[model samples]
Target: MAKILVVDDELGIRVSLWRALEFSGHKVTLAKDGEEGDRLFRENPTDLVITDLVMPKKEGLEFMSGLLVDFPDLKILVISGGGVKASSKDIELLLDTAQTRGAVKTFAKPFELHEILACVRDLLAADAD
Candidate 1:
């Protein structure tokens, strides 16, 4: 099992993802915002991070970029709802920037739970090799 961090500003998003990841037999940590996520990651290094692109404090790009600066090969999966009415292009740009910043994969919010779980397992498996 891998230690995974789930970072998002929304309570429901965090809880649902936490439950899903835990159910998949991985240790899951929840953070309300990028600031908390960064602190938690520093306190306990995790195998993977799943973060939202936009948040109340610190934002995803800055948070993940900072971590990548320290751990260049860190695995990150990004997700974002963007603005309430965000255009698809906007989300694409946001996620693409995350990839440029260092995230290994990206997902738009309302993403399938199964898809995220599968990606998580895949990333961890790749790391294990």
Candidate 2:
């Protein structure tokens, strides 16, 4: 089983991702914000990291940069809940930027849990090979 870290400012999101990772037979760790995420990451490296793009304290981009510096080959998935009324263009831009920053997959807010799980599975599987 792979070790996975879930990072999000929202408690609900962190729980949901944790459950999904557990159900998928992976070991999961939870971090409430980017700063905490970075701390945990430095302490114990995980096989993968799933983080929210927008958050309190340090943001996802900052976390990504730090991870790459410390763990160049670390795999990541980024999620963002841009807005209930955000323009499609803005959301696209955010996603594109995340992809450029080491995220193998980017999911928008209100996304299906299954979709996120699928991405996680795919990324982990790819890394295993």
Candidate 3:
């Protein structure tokens, strides 16, 4: 089993994702925002990171860029609800930037649980090789 970190601002999203990842047999850690997410990551590295693109304190892109500097090979899966303040086009642009910054995958909010689980599995399997 892989150690996975789920970083999100919404309580429901964080809890549900933590539950799903735990149920899938991976050791998981939860963080409410990128600031805490950054600390958690440095404290204990994980096989993968699934984070929301928009958050308070620090956004996913910022957190991710910092991590990439030190852990260039880190695997990151980004998710976003387009923020309450952002337009659809803004979200798309942000997600595109995340991809350029090294997110292995990006999912818009309302993405299926199955899709996430499958992507996690595939990424871990690929890493195993």
Best-fitting candidate, measured by lDDT?
3
Global fold similarity of model 3 (TM-score): 0.97
Evaluate all candidate structures by whole-model CA lDDT and list the values in order. Answer: 0.92, 0.87, 0.94
Per-residue lDDT for 39-94 in model 2, tens only? 99889999999998788899898988889987888998988886456777878888
Off by over 4 Å in 1: none
lDDT, candidate 2, at 55: 80
RMSD, one per candidate, in order:
0.8, 1.4, 0.8
Report the Cα lDDT for residue 129, model 3: 91
lDDT of 1 by residue, 92-126 (tens): 99988999888999999889999999999899998
The sequence of per-residue lDDT tens digits that candidate 3 reaches over residues 12-71 is 998889889999999999999999999999999998999998899999999999999999
Question: Which sections of candidate 3 miss by over 4 Å?
Answer: none
Model 3 residue 122 CA deviation (Å) reads 0.4
In candidate 1 the C-alpha lDDT for residue 14 amounts to 95
Worst 10 residues of 3 by lDDT: 81-90
